[model samples]
Target chain A: MKQYDVVVIGAGPAGLAAACEAYQNGAGKILVVERDKEPGGILNQCIHNGFGLHYFKEELTGPEYAGRFIEMLNNTNAELMLDTMVLAVTEDRKISMINPRDGYFTVQAGAVVLAMGCRERTRGAIGIPGTRPAGVFTAGAAQRYVNIEGYMVGKKVVILGSGDIGLIMARRMTLEGAKVAACVELMPYSNGLNRNIVQCLNDYGIPLYLSHTITEIRGKRRVEGVVVSRVDGGGKPVPGTERFFDCDTVLLSVGLIPENELSRSAGIALDPRTKGPVVYENMETSIPGIFASGNVVHVHDLVDFVTAESQRAGAAAADFCRRKEQPGGEPAVAIESGENVGCTVPQHIRPDRIDQYAEVFFRVGRVFSNSEIEVASGGRVLSVFKREHMAPGEMERIVIPKKFLENASGGAVTVSAKEAKEN
Target chain B: MTHLICIICPKGCHLNVDEQNGYAVTGNGCPRGAEYGKKELTNPTRVLTSTVKIKGGLHRRCPVKTDRAIPKGLMFDAMKLLNGVELSAPVRRGDVVLADLLGTGANLVVTKSM
Candidate 1:
């Protein structure tokens, strides 16, 4: 069996960044496996720009962003295995992979990095009461057809969710001469970025029905129309508020779930909230020497965040491969989200681990204004962050300095938000 | 007064620009917001990113974007301008398909080759 110092799965932004960083961090032999035919995973289909604003300091299209990383990877020593599907990963860092070119192969790795991104929520997952119609397609699927495949899915559309991809598609469809009837979002607020809402919907005069959902899709052969109605806070459809949109298609942008079948098969501990593996500060999973990052760990709002986090995972994996096994010290402190916060990544932090600081990313359950987010450890306050506005759609981040974590009471750290008092 | 939300960052600061007072801005979080507020009301611009019809390549459509942000009001027209573009394979990234986009100096350049 072939052995490598590091093996990164999925050649998307996450995988590309991880492998590049791993090679840069002194990993002698690294292999990156990608299921896609090309190195640029979903980014190839995502032709629209508005990416790399933070990482590259310049707004770039999806393919452009991935291209830069692929260029960076060309300079590194990491070997890429494209069109290869990772079947399973064992607890011992052995990956079983197969491809059309290569029948099957197994390789043992000193460290494994899981960078497989997330998948979109399908119509079946959301249980939209619709007939088996031809015009039904996931937002991403339709995006692939229009952008990459150069095929039009429908002439008229009614999008079910206000997801960023969905919003971008609305504009794309309009530009292609498709009339978007309405965008029905179950949540009152949009799941997309503020810029998307302005550029896609508000600018195009597309009516956004907030707190509304599609109750029934009226179609026998193809999607002819859909029945939409307003929903209360409890998510129950209101009868009188029923409305209909005569359209040919319905694009679902509901939600995304972490693609973690391989991670689950690896016997790694999974976080119920993030649907990804629970890991230490170094992104090392429950299984030693195995690490995870990007959307596979948690659904990140920004690809820039995915790149940054993957770099850490890559460096950590390289560091793990270089260092000899030793007796571990100090139980890691579990980080918990307190009031108003949803879930915090890096569920646990090992203070003894070498690091400058851990940047924790999370989102709030509800919107708040003039709020102060406080971090506490063992009932003692650690840090306080003030925010002008907080929304569930936007992911929030905070830094836990090494000094604060090292001197902690060895108890779990909790982060909570509260309304700021007027002086 | 023209109300707009600053999209420069995640902050999404809401700004109210008084057109009567030379677009005096309010409710901005930073200086960027102030600039965005003034430009948005006076002359709004956005970078146009989409695909042009491609032939004899791996993909049928090659992604392209304006070299720089052009007038927001000109986006629909710019897209119409792109609709007429049909290129064969061998197109390189940053290859300008159309120069002087709507006379805005923002050239429409291909972001990906095939």
Candidate 2:
């Protein structure tokens, strides 16, 4: 079996960034295994702009944003094995992989970084009660067809979710001369970024039906139309408010689930909420020398955040390779979600580990205006962050000063949101 | 008065622009919001990213985008112009498909190699 200092799974934005960071951080023999025929991952299928506005400090398309990283990858000696699928990953840092060229092989690694990214939630997950049809497609699948294969999905389309991909596709299909009837959402507010809503839907004069869902897909072979109805607070359909749209296509963008099959097989602890591997301050998983980042850990609102985060995990994995830290014996506190906060990433943090500050990213369970996010250790508030608006669509972060952790009384840390109390 | 979401970043600051008062901006999180508010109300523009036909490539299409933002009004025409273009394989990233497209001073460039 061949051996490497570090092995990163999935050469998407996360893997690429992580691999590059590990190599730069002085980890030798870094290998990036990718299942796709090429790098850049899903970004290649996403041709719309508005990416990298934070990382690159410029508005760029997905390809442009990913191209920058691919260009950077060229400058590094990190090896990328394209079209190679990792069949299994072991807890002790061994990976079983296969490719048409290499047949099958097992490679040992000093450290492993999981960056498998995520997959879109299909119609089955949401259990949209309907007849099977040809025109039903996931938003990502339709994106690949239109943007990459240059094939239009349908002439008239109705999207089932207000996710960023669905909203962006609504605009893409419209630009490609297809008529997008409506973008329906179960939640009252869109799950996509505000900018996407304004530019992709509002700019194109497309109607967005919030608090609505596709109750039934009406079609025989290809789609003919759909029955959209408003949903009550409990998400049950409100029958009388059914609206029908005659369309050939129904794109589902319900949600994204972190691909953590390999993580489970590796026996790494998983976070129930994020559906990804649980990690500590350094992004190291329950099993030492194994780290996870990006969508493989939790879905991020922006790819730029994935890039930034994976880099940190990459650097930490490199440090793990050099230091060869033992698995999980250190004193740490579990950081959990509370009140309005949906879930927090890096489910645990080792106090006084000394990284300047610890960044905990999470999403709110719902929309909150005029609110403040409070980070509490035990029963006492350590820090409070004020925001004008917070929504489930956007990922929020609150930095915990090292000082607070250094002074912590050694208990679980919880992040919660509340309406600002009048002084 | 017009309210706009600054697309400059994920912060998505909401800006209210008084068009009659030199596009005075409010509710911005950063300096870029002011500029976005003014330009959005005056002459809205956007970066066009899409796929163009490609020959002799593994895939039938190669992704392309405007090297810079162009007037939003010209997006349809710009897309129409690309419909007439067909490039062969070996098209490198940043390669110009159309220079100074639609006289907007922004080149339509390939964002990836074919």
Candidate 3:
């Protein structure tokens, strides 16, 4: 058994960023454990651009974005364990890890950062009734195979979701000389960025069918075709609207669930809303000294935000371990979604810290134009900003001034959107 | 009439524009239709990614990408410039493969090391 001042699990972008922060913040001994042979995590397989626009003020591909932090980590005092899978973590911050290279190890930590990230939702999880065929693949799996392994999944394909991965895969398959029959989306609007809809589909001349779903996946040993249908307003399939397309593969990108089995086994309270560990303003979970960030906290569209969030989590963990004073005493108020808004993270906000301003990230449920997003508490609007347009595919955030929280007497704080009244 | 194409989704709308009549668009489903139409009529843009030649490394080629979004009109030219380049090994990821390629203000970044 070895002891470390800070231990970060899963060396993805979040974990890498967190480990660097912890070490920089004066953690004596730091260890980063990654299950993969390499440390970049999912970013290694994400070969496309559109990351780092906010954090680095430039666009970068996934690997390039993640590599920036990895370079930083190399210069720090952090130690890394590759090919190591952390099996469990106790509420007391004890970790159990298995590495074929390092064998089994158990250690207690002054602080633990859970950056295991999230997992892609599979066919069984979504309950798409279909034959257990061989050609079915998740968008991420396909991305890894094509981008990293340099092998094509199939020649003709029909993707099942319009999530960012599925959309990007559609273009990827087409560019690699495969015929993408169509990109079927269950929702009325796409769950990807507008830029993706353009670059990944429209530019490639692939079709996107909205309010539609793959009712049945038809295949035996391999996918032969799929049954698609139009969905009703309530998101259920309408009878007689079925259509069939012969294809060789089915890609599922329905959604991502934060991987928290270890967190759950540790008896940490999970937030049902985010499907992640409930974290406070500092990204610390209900269990003290154990922090969580990145996709494990809640799925984020941009890797830039993930890096930024993890920095805070890492700094907070280092402070926890060092017994140093932190920016505390802000009672968090729950942030609820209203109208066209979806869910918000750090669900609770510290009213007392309002003077320090906080960056709130969220998603819109649908596409709308000329909208006013109002952050309110107790029915009184705290701040309002006008957005030219908002989409479900893009992650939206607002930096609320610290004064807004200082002015609030403490009631339910919610972020809601309303159509901007005609000027 | 400046014909504009809306590439917002798979539903590509070929928009007909009459510059004299303030550009009334004919084939747009969403407001983005109008936005794309206007942008196409003015400055079309796209993000470009490819590879660059590196020195002192393991593999023959290292994958390079754009550090920012570039104009669409400069895309094909950008790819042509990036395709012919090569880099040496030991080229760390995020290193600048080509700084300000063709003067679009977008730097080409290294994505994968060779």
Ten contiguous residues with the weakest lDDT in model 3 chain A:
A324-333
The best candidate by DockQ is 2
Where does candidate 1 stray beyond 4 Å?
A326-329
Which residue ranges in model 2 land beyond 4 Å of their true spot? A324-328
**Pairs of residues at least 3 apart in sequence or in different chains that clash in candidate 2:** none
- DockQ each candidate and list the results: 0.65, 0.73, 0.19
* Error at A245, model 1, angstroms: 0.8
TM-scores for chain A over all candidates: 0.98, 0.98, 0.94
Question: What does candidate 1's lDDT look like per residue over B1-114, in tens digits?
Answer: 988988776557889999999889999988988998999888888788888898998878899999888888888898898889999999888899999998999899988756
User: What class would a CAPRI assessor give candidate 2's docking?
Assistant: medium
Task: Report the Cα lDDT for residue A406, model 2.
Answer: 70
List model 1 lDDT by residue over A100-119, tens digit each. Answer: 98799999999999999999
Q: Order of all candidates by TM-score, from best down to worst?
A: 2, 1, 3
Note the residue pairs that clash in candidate 1.
none
Q: lDDT of model 3 at residue A195?
A: 62
Per-residue lDDT over A179-288 for candidate 3, one digit per residue giving the tens place of the 0 to 100 score: 99999999998887666787778777899999999999888899899999999999999999999999999999899999999999998888887799887667888888
